[model samples]
Target: MIRQIFLALTLAAATALPVAAERIGDAARGATLFDRQCKACHQIGDGATNRVGPTLSNIFGRKAGTVAGFKYSKSITRMGADGLTWTLQTLDAYIENPKALVSGTRMNYRGMADASARADLMAFLRDYSDQPANIPESEPTARKSEPTLDPAILAIQGDPEYGAYLSSECSTCHRRDGADEGIPAITQWPPEDFVVAMHAYKSKLRPHPVMQMMASRLSNDEIAALAAYFATLE
Candidate 1:
């Protein structure tokens, strides 16, 4: 009876072990994975600066889109305004699928599909968090190349009148008053930023199904008009 009880207890402990390990993850392995998967855009550790993506040195408890000097997408900025702080669970969800969490995020990666891999990556990131004095002096990561836009398309002057007319379709999901409940707000965006983001969606680079479809149907002028209209919002 004693032996049998010991075996049962051991089995139970074994079952719990995987869950604990998954939560903690192997930070060393996560570092390697980060180099391959995230280093092209995101930087971390000591002396890390914003690259294509924001520097993620202390990202765990930080609010989204609060990184200074980086131009965040309206989606992420709205999320931050709506109280989206980065925690382990929230980061996990965002890493699993960015669009699912923030519909118009400009992160540009499809997402880490493997839960274990994401855990590892998160573990790597957590190392730098909450330790302002002791951050590791890691080398800066390479920046991802951005797609260049046509100068003419960017130079196109949009009519806010036309934009207001087209904005009805956009207002269905994005609130005109700039509230981001689930969907990100579109109001008060810079026209150039708005234009670039729409073009990204049209090219299918931004990776939201609804946005891709919506942008696919709009002409360049229409997108420019919408950008102009949304920028005027207070």
Candidate 2:
């Protein structure tokens, strides 16, 4: 009976292994990945502005039609005007398949197929964009020195300190430390890859109306600064 029981336990443990294999994105790793894969197109935080792509700063809670200057595809702009907010889940779905998420988005890059990779990248993005807070037990006294300009209207040549200041909006969907509400922390990505994404969005190669608006608003200088800022997030 003891041997039989032990075998059953072993089988149960074996069955649970796959569940544990689902690794979540770490902000540190996501940063690495972002640096290696994204810098070319995307930027967030500080003086970071939209470039070829829409600015990624505080993307979590933004409305779909927002982003200052990018001219989104007609469909996407309509979606935003209808009032669609980007939640973590929305981001995840969109990242997995940009075209599927927004039919008219101009992004030409295929989706990031790896769930873990996408999660890690997101975490890195959040960390790169947030403003530092004292985080007292009682709501860190609403951060001062926040940016008032629309993300799309902001310039792209980023200021690292400013990028850090702007990054605070990311906390709504991405967590700095670990997974939160199904949103994974990301830390690794490539800068070049990001830049390309921005370009795709700005050029309307990627079809997100909100992203296009944001991308159109940014200057190239702002894009580089945001990329540089995220590279250091981890």
Candidate 3:
């Protein structure tokens, strides 16, 4: 009777572990999914080298933006400095929505909405983990070159007065004092980065619905105006 009780308790403990802790997901299915979705930008497995994205070899348990020779966006670098490590949970969140996890990240992925698909991708990525010693010291290629903005657009001197009027729409969600609650703070961003980010949203590359809607309606000059105004925030 005591032996049966012990077995039941052990089974219960095993069943109670989180799905990620158990590493649930079919690696075979994950491989196929990776080929379909991630093969273009990222590379993995033996002889893998960085392409548009960093090589995924030994990615699990690695610190974000710490890969040598890779020029990461400031947002991801800041998150890494804040101790964001690549784990099953973190990677899952990032893969689900790049902008949601790291606002202003230059990764152009629109995000995977299917939970099962994300799980499979995570499984495929996990296969490349725990082999840091075996990774080759290859020079990383630049991750996707940014498109050049028109000089005319970049040179547009913003009207801060007009920007102040436009800012009434933005201040509802983003705090002027830079307190980041659920939404990220936009205050004090470099004007160029702010312009680029707004353009990305306008182009449907950033994948946030509200931001896309807001940016899509703004003219290039209006975007510049907003950028200039936001940059001046203390």
Model 1 TM-score relative to the real fold: 0.49
Over 1-234, each residue of candidate 2 has an lDDT whose tens digit, in order, gives 112211222323433332212222477888887777666787767787887777877665578867898766776688777876665456666777888778888776687777667768766665543333532222111111111223343334456675454445444555645355675453333554445455445555445566556666556565555555554676
Off by over 4 Å in 3: 1-21, 131-234
- In candidate 2, clashing pairs total 75
In terms of TM-score, the best-performing candidate is 1
* lDDT digits (tens) for residues 139-169 of candidate 3: 1111111223565877888887888889899
List per-prediction Cα lDDT, in the order shown.
0.76, 0.56, 0.73
- Expressed as tens digits, the lDDT of each residue in 1-234 for candidate 1 is 112211222323333332211234678999999999899999998899999999998787789999999999999999999999887667878988899899999999898877668767877887887742554443112111112367688898999999999999999999998999999999988899898778766765455789879988999899999999999977
Best by lDDT: 1
Give the clash count for model 3: 0
Q: Which of the two, 1 or 3, has more lDDT?
A: 1
State which candidate, 2 or 3, has the greater lDDT.
3
* 1 versus 2: better lDDT goes to: 1
